[model samples]
Target: MAASMWRKMRTYVSRKNIHRLIFDPQCAIFSMFLLLIAEVAVNILVIKKIKYTEIDWKAYMQEVEGVVNGTYDYTKLRGDTGPLVYPAGFVYVYMALYYVTSYGHHIRLGQYVFALLYILSLVILFDIYRKTKRVPPYSFIFMCCASYRIHSIYVLRLFNDPVAMFFMYVAINFFLRDRWSIGCLMYSFGVSIKMNLLLFSPAILMLLMVRFGTLKTLLHLIVCAVPQIVLAVPFLLENPVGYVVRAFNFGRQFFYVWTVNWRLIPEEIFLNKYFQTALLILHVTFLILFFVFKWRRLYPGVGFGILMKESPTALSPNQILLPLFTSNLIGMSFSRSLHYQFYVWYFHTLHYLLWSTTQPPIVKILVLGVIELCWNTYPSTVLSSSLLHVCHAVLLYGLWYSPDYTPNDKNLTATKVD
Candidate 1:
């Protein structure tokens, strides 16, 4: 019976189109499993062979150490790099790490732990791709094995960026599964770890409003806010003003020396308040346009007022994924400054976003290659920064014109390589 079943399966697969095979959901799953196994070995090899570069790990330990040693005042908590600027969840998470890794001295164990996180993040991301079936199987290789910077960010640098993103991706996965309440909770947890996760907020808000209507969306908003309130209670008790000011400071100035995305602009202009204001305007403008023209096209003639009172509608998986990722990408494009460690913010979403665009296959591949090169360039030269912007423009254009897939659209499930 087993042999017969295997033969039948082989025959069925053989009859399918070769291109379909490459884009086959089953093939994608198989490739993901293989990559996960290979990634485990690769992470181990990276930890063993490469010297773990200490950029923010020690500072993270110090910040959390203060909380563990009974310091809850956000103003008083200091690390080697600077004061604790991240939210309360970061404190709790790293405090656990501090204890487990021998008061934060066990560096090797920490690397191994982060390696586990990287794998877990990939698992969540793979599940998202599997559900959407937008990108082909080969793209998984580039996502997992092609980028040295991603590996370094996860294991070598031990930046809190990956930790926050791990939760963010979890939230995204849950959103794809239509578990909005849990997704909001997980998203708030990610925000608690680091503020960068908030970059996905505009998109999340749009999704919630569409899926649950206005009143229920407020309940979901409360679900998101409660975790943040619960997490910050300790710090809030010590100094409510300080906790609010430091942990979620939106006006904090970024150091020009470490910026990865704005090398083409002069330092004076980069530091100018007007420059940031302009970027903020551009960001808002792009988001509004996307929401009105692109995302809302899924529900034609459904205005904001209508959507507010309308019955809850089940969204296509890609509908849930695309806007959130595109929103982040737009934010990144207009960001004040992007440090090297910030790559993890949108790295995992690149493949999905690229495949969602209407650009030619070669254009998509070139854009991906240029982006990888741009991020990998240390201190980011003028040419690299310019090239990065060009790539971003190309992608934004492609996404703008790309076909919108409705919930009942047959094309939503059609997997195409080109």
Candidate 2:
């Protein structure tokens, strides 16, 4: 009787059915929920153990207030030395928050709001992954279990980056859907939130030119600039040069102790004015090389026609979405001033890329494992600045090239037909 029962059970569980079960969305959702719970527990521990009172709540509150009241002066707020740093649209979001909270007194309330944004970002990331056809269920599960949630917690204390990342993802979503005009508008909104995104503007322009051709692309680009122009009209009229200087040149003037790469090299070398000039030149040169030499050849027009040749059933919209997503993630990694929370933006992108590739499973696991470990260490405060910077630079550089040479087609289809 026992042998008969075992045979029946084995017959009922077919190999094909088991494979289907493994890849099911229900399984993925359950796994993500458990991972989220674990992450929240860890965050609670980190917040409780750390001295939360050490944060500059008063200064943050004052900035929040300044952003709410349009009358608040940037020069006075920055002490006449620092640039405005943030774009004007950020003030609008803060103003909305202020109104909602009725200008709440407690700083912890602001922290909680930031935390909710972090959670919303995670949900957006999952949507990006689900929309990408080439991504595998297993890979998505791995991302859910990774260090992305931990990084979000670190960003919760610093509100600006979370808001910036949210807008960046919004821009990416629009771009994926072939809405270039809307994408550009979202990109402008993102830059307004944080000037750091300006680094990726060149890449954005290149993508627009490629997708829409010359005249139309130029027109769209101009349209996108409208927001910035309107926001700056007041400052521009008051002092054009000063406004330009504050908007563009301010970040270049001051060096922060928390800057990652500066600590890696010799202090004397990093401190020299010539060193900054040389570094700027080097970064620009490499960025140009990436676009002109490496990226151009990787796409369809440059003789990789075989790679670009669409699958018989593949939708053009899907084909376009993959590249759009790739460009955004690569752009973010190349950006300067990438704080810890910015990792949330790329988690889904990384998973999609990994799932689409044909690389051995072991290699994927190793690379992702290392990335998670590095992201988790960042908020620990145990690692030296030099080490953190080195790790960040290396990981980002590695990620940019990883999907380029791989042979996965998960991102090539509009939807999973199987």
- Top model number, lDDT: 1
Q: Report the alpha-carbon TM-score of model 2 versus the true structure.
A: 0.72
**Model 1 poorest 10 in a row by lDDT:** 409-418
Scanning candidate 2 in windows of ten residues, the lowest lDDT window is 305-314
Clashes of 1: 0
Off by over 4 Å in 2: 1-57, 67-73, 79-83, 102-104, 141-145, 148-155, 233-240, 250-256, 297-348, 353-359, 375-418
Model 2, C-alpha of 64: deviation from truth (Å) = 4.3
Q: By TM-score, how accurate is candidate 1?
A: 0.93
* Candidate 2 lDDT, 1-418, residue by residue in tens: 9999998888767786556545654345544555567656655554555444423334544555754455344554441223355656765666566665557454455655665665676676665555554454566557644554444444335456567767777776776666668878887888777665665566666666555556677778887799888876765665666656655554464344334324345556656677666656656666666565445533444232212322222123335444444555555543443444555555555665554455666766666776666555533343444444444455445545655533353433233222
* Native-referenced Cα lDDT, model 2: 0.55
Task: Tell me the whole-model lDDT of each prediction, alpha carbons only.
Answer: 0.87, 0.55
User: Best candidate per TM-score, number?
Assistant: 1
Which ranges in model 1 have alpha carbons more than 4 Å from their true place? 1-21, 310-312, 405-418
For residue 370, what is the lDDT in candidate 1? 93
